[model samples]
Structures are given as C-alpha cells and as structure tokens.
Target: MFRGTGFGTYYYDVRQVEACDTSFVAQNLSPLECSSQNALSLNHVNSNYVVAMNHSQLKLDMSKYCGKRVIVTVNGEQSNLPLFIGDGCQRCAGGSASSDVWNAVAAPGLDFSYSVLEELSGGAACADGHIQIAWEIVDDTIYNFSDGVNFETAPAEASEERTTSSAALVMSTSLSAASFLHTPVNDDPVQNAVAVLARQGYGDATEASSNNALPTDGLLASLAEPR
Candidate 1:
C-alpha cells in the first residue's frame, strides 16, 4: 500500500504467479491523473499492460505485447478486438516484463474500480497471426518443400491462343517435370484444340439434311460413313 500526502489517496497492489493487480484511491482529487494530469495520456506502469481511469473515461495500455499476440478482458468483458501488438493501447516503461499490473486512484468526482485480465498464452504468437510461432520455433527446420512445378524454359512457341505452344507447356513438360514426376500427367489437350475442331464442317449441310437429320452422333456418322 502506498499513501499520498492528500486526505484520501493511496495505491495498493496484489501479486499472482501470472498476473499483478493494483488499486488506487482518490478523495477530493479532481481531474485525477495516474500517468499525468491529462487522463488521455497513458501511465508508464512497469508491466506490459496498464489501465487508468478518469472521471470521463478509462484508458489502457497493452502495447508491450506488440508483435506478441495477446487478449485482454475489462471488468469481465472480453475486448474481442485485434490484439495487434504495438498498435493497440500504449507502450509502458520496461515493456511487459516490468509489472503485469499497476493502479492508481483519484476521487472527489466519483467512485469506481476496474479489473483487467490479460492472457498471453491464448493469442496468436507472432507478428503475423497467420503462422504459429510456437510450432515454427520448436521445429527450427532449415528447409521446406511444396508439391508443384517450376518453369525454367525459354519460350519456344509463345502463342496466346494455344497452351501447348506457350512457355508454360515447355516448362511443364521439361523444366518442371522433375518436380511433378510422381504426379499423374494430364492426358487432355488444351481448349484451343476443341475450339478449332468445333469449327470444322460446321454449317456445311444442305437445308434438307440440316432440317430433317439431327446433328446427333448417329446422324453425323451415318452421313460420313454410309452403310
């Protein structure tokens, strides 16, 4: 417990294995400030996280966890906010290593108390939430492999309409072959071939045959190969 010279002002702290809790008292103190006279400014608590309150609003600091993902709850309400390190809250002195919690109280305006909980173990562990730093750090692998092909060939027939004549074909068949050797090869030709074939012999039939005989396979085969 810390006492101030004024009538009713003091600071108290409770310690836990994973957390530190602090409380403050303010009596006959107007515009009470923890970090400074301005309530907008964040206090420099020893810990990575800090919470301060003024007559009008509450201020918090969790910036120490920047680059290190974390989540916080205030008065039992989870923030559910992006706990992006360095971005949210204010950076305190000595980082999160200093004090897990710190508090100060001021009054003569109103009486209130605040409770905060910070869980470092549950949030994303890295700057980019995409990768789990724990898994990556533990593995310490020097190399990674992906199943795909890489093209290393010069354009032999760079045709825009035909894939077989494009650089991708040369890479897939030759340079990229080494990577996809185990994968089954694609047997079907490119779409350009099908389009070219569709144009052949189209609209060539006489009106009588076109109207009477359907263009079904049977009719087409009968016309081409007479029985």
Candidate 2:
C-alpha cells in the first residue's frame, strides 16, 4: 500500500497477449489512452473502430509488410479502457474494425495497418473516460488519427429558449427601477463585493418640489447581463 495523504494503496495494470486466431487478449485494466498502430494511410482519416473492455487488444506488429502504406480506423465508447500488446491483443494483425456492446461502459474499435514497429501507449485520454485513435502506414510515413467527437453522458433536452419583446422591456424597466433585486449571487468576485444595489429605471428625475424625494438616480444600471 502506498502511504501518503490519507489515500489508500492504489494500483493499475493492463493485459495484451496474442492468441492463435490473430487476436490479442487484454485482462486486468487501468485507465490508459490508446493510439493507432498503422501510421500511414489515407482511409484512416475518416473511420473508427471498437475495442472491448478486459477482452483482447488490437495488435501492432507489422513485420509482414515493412514497405507499404495502409489505412485504419478506430472507434470506441467505453470506460475503464486498456492498452493491448502481444498475447493479450484483440487483433494481432493490426487491421480490423469492431462493433460496440450494448450498455457497455466503453468499447474501442480500431482500423490500422501493421507495417513496422508498434508503440503501445496508455492513458491517452488522461481521465477514466475512453478515447480512441487510429493508425495508418503508406509509402513510409506513419500516420496517427482520430476525429474530435464528444458524446454527452446524458442526453440533451430538446428545449428552446423564448422571450417576447414585452418581456424584455419589462425586464429592462425592472432593472433601472426604484426597487430592483437580483437572483442568487454569481461566482464573479465583483458581484460578491457589491454590498448594495439600486436602479432608477422608471420615474422621472425632473426637479419636482424639494418636499418630494426625486426618484433615486440609477447607480447600478444594467447590473447583470441578460441570459
């Protein structure tokens, strides 16, 4: 156990082993980022794949084709991702795509070509979230790829924001009025320091008799930005 700041012992790991069917096995897991094995190809620019959690990993060894270019895709949507290598690899050939599992935390699918030495990296996403990358090899250049796609954990509410001209006018009038108050304070330091707030949106500022209190002049005009 690692002794430190009130935290208990922490450990992490991943498994990648190659089997006879041209696939790698991945057992035990730690949060690790993934990258493509095929480093140089054209198709890799716009394709994706999937890798299962704790199953096997995709292969990277491409000794079979040392001087050719190939394209690959990687797609995934799983958490608790792993990095595969050698025997634990899900695909030893480094060329294939995978389908996703229903209701799975995160699954990765990759399309890459094996043309040379493969660098198996981990924790590509940094957090426990899953991120997928693809590899391609053409001619001699090695290409790594993935598109910037984000899937929200929760589905978006299909709602619209609506406000009429009268509503806006009323709000404006209310702000510079004799009596005005805002909702809860925001995180901005400037708002926190404002001890008093008052606006004179309505009422005239003309000098009526000295007996009557002229509507207070607006010191706090348009205090908050309209959402």
Candidate 3:
C-alpha cells in the first residue's frame, strides 16, 4: 500500500505511447518500442479510474503492480484503479488519471487532455494547473498480466460503490508524472541540457558518459542549430 498527499491531474485520448512523444512518457523504453505494449486504455480497462504515476517516486518492482488493481482514494472517495508507471525524473508530486475520475470530482473544461486546473478548482482559478489531492493505494494484488489484458466489466450499479478489503503489504509514498503543457522545468542548466538530449532520443543521459561530466559547450551549441 502506498499513501500520501500530492497533486492530481486528469488525462484522456492517450491510447498509445509513441517514439519521442511527450504524451504518455514512460521511464522504460521497451513499452514505447513495442506496438502491443501500452498503458491501460480507458476503453479497454474495466474501471474508469486508471492512473499512471512517476516511476522514480514509486520505485516499486514493476512486476508487483503491472497488471494488478490498487485501491485509490481521493477526497474520501475510493475506487479500484489500474496502475502504471509514467515519466520518471520530470515529475515530482502529481500523477495523471483518466478523465472519468476527474469528472467525478470536478467540472469539465477542455476537450483535450492536459493538466487539471480550472476543472478541479470548483469555479476558483488555480495558478499551478494542478489540484492538491490526498490519495492512497490502499491495496494491491499479484495478478497475471495475460488475464488482465482482457478486462472484465463490472455491473453498472457496482461501479461507484465497489470496494476492496484484501490484506496487502503497506508501503507509503507520493506519486507524480508530467503533463504535456505543464511539466516543471528544472533550474539547473546541466540538468536541463541533459533533459533536452534525453527528449530527442539520445538515451538516458544519467547513464550516457562513463565519467558523467556535464554536457560540453560544443554539444549545447550544436543543439541550438536547426534540425
């Protein structure tokens, strides 16, 4: 079980991860390279509360939650949501959720997925493009990934009222992931430069050079030139 108060945002229409695409960023590259690999699709998943968290923050063995259900609580409202890992180092406090979960707590605004801002503000505007939320993964189970791929739908009446009480190992931590428009930029120039290189499919900068030196001025100058 993972629990903490952090930030939350809603996302939709992100059915697949793409090469070098900012949306649905993942720490692992294997998922992005394989066409069949994907985050839980809203249409395919049985529940409406699927979410993706920052891999770095969660730091759990992927095998534990890859295809399992976790009980997620927000604002005293609880739901069993499918969990996945999103971008690692870019996000710190907030992770992304499906739009259905967002609609339950706040008003609808933009048709496209970004970050939850005014939609979650309850008519009040928020400058951060995010809403502070208390959320927790109260329970999780070991599940077969193959079986989970073909999800089952629960009865409509049970959707909102569903609850889980299974005993699970309790682990506490905050979750986070970046949104397309509102990803917080790092202040350190070297970190920023490394991030730019990583975004361009240059492989993980943290593991790139044997000596781990800051990117040279020549390399930074080259990045400024038009591709």
Candidate 4:
C-alpha cells in the first residue's frame, strides 16, 4: 500500500520486472488518511522483481528478512544495499508513537518502485488492478531497529551446527538414544546431529501416520551412507 502524507495529485505506478510501467491514478492518497491504500502480495525468488513508485516504506518492511546479511535492491540498482526498517515508521514500528523512533533517511528526491517476497501467506487478495503487499519470513524474531545503528548484525541464529566443531563434544554426554531424541534442537553443539536424531526417529507418537515414517527412513539411509 503506497500512500503519501498530505497528498495532492500523486501517482502510484507499478511495473513488472523488465516490463512496461502501469500507472494507478489515485486522486488523494495520503498516509495520514486511509482511502487509496493499494493492497498486494508477492512471491519472490531469484530473477523475480517489480518496480513501483514510492516504495521507500516497502523497503523497510522487507529489511526484516535481510537482518544484516542481505540487501534490498531497487529498480535494478542497489540504492540501500543493506536496508533496515527505521524506527519512526508507524507501520514498521508496530503503530507506536515514540520520540525515540527515528524516521527513515532515504536518498532525497528518489521515487521508489515495488516488490518483496519470502513466505507471505493469507493476505487479503488483491482485487482487479490493485497492488498487493507480499513478504516472506526470513526469521520470525522481532527486530529492534533502535538496538544501536549497526546494520551488520546478522538476524536470527543459524540452524544448529553453527557452533562448535568437535566430535569429542558429543562423547562427553551419555549417548542414550531415548534421551538424545528428547533433546531440544537448540543446544551448544552436537556432532552427527541430524543423523543421530534421525536414527532414533521424530514426531510425537500420537501424531504418527503411515507416511510419517517414510521420510525418516530416507534421511537415516542418506546419513548412514559414506560421504
């Protein structure tokens, strides 16, 4: 939903990647008042891109997925290579008016374009000729933009195996398959983690179905195979 504050004659233009521009004519679209909010959704992957006007706010929303490792590209150019949601935007800040919140500092006098993606589901479907706000969850953790001004902080801990690199670490713990199965996926470190977990099995017994056992067999087989 691309809307400006205190609008006069504002144009909301949208274009598919490498495609011609399509314009949406809104008479009075202001962020202050609601009436011309264009709702849209996007499922983005490599090589998928869209262009639209006034997408500065959109960039902030998408920055959550990136954390510090990724970049948000605009219109075939890297304007804000590593973008973060600024503190002041009401939509991004969860609708709180805090003095501590800082407004996004965009490059002056630049009209932004559209598009973002990464696991967005169940939004009010875009009607004919309306734009949708699409997004995916890079990490579900709440990002505090005001947690100091370093954009390089990586978002969310990587799946286990990021820490520690010693097979001896697992040897220190008693290797009870039952106890191992119950171990929470979160931990300091574990070698042969996935295979070990797969060996014992997964899922609550109550939730088991015929197909539930099939994938685990393949996983165990693969893990047991020589590298």
Alpha carbon lDDT at 68, candidate 4: 23
Residue 55, candidate 2: alpha-carbon lDDT: 24
lDDT of 1: 0.26
Off by over 4 Å in 4: 1-122, 129-153, 159-168, 171-227
Worst 10 residues of 1 by lDDT: 129-138
Question: How would you encode candidate 2's per-residue C-alpha lDDT over 15-92 as one tens digit per residue?
Answer: 222322222222222222233342322222221122211123222332322222333323422222212211112322
Error of 4 at 184 (Å): 33
Steric clash pairs (candidate 3): 94-176
| Tens-place lDDT digits, model 3, residues 45-136 | 43223444544444445444343444434456653334432222224423343332333233221111232223344433324344555554
lDDT of 1 at 170: 81
Once model 4 is optimally superposed onto the true structure by TM-score, how far is the C-alpha of residue 164 displaced, in angstroms?
7.8
* lDDT of model 4, residue 224: 54
lDDT of 2 at 53: 19
Q: What's the TM for model 4?
A: 0.18
Clashes of each: 8, 53, 1, 11
Estimate candidate 3's RMSD in Å: 27.6
- Compute the lDDT of residue 88 as modeled in candidate 3: 25
TM-score for each model: 0.19, 0.19, 0.35, 0.18
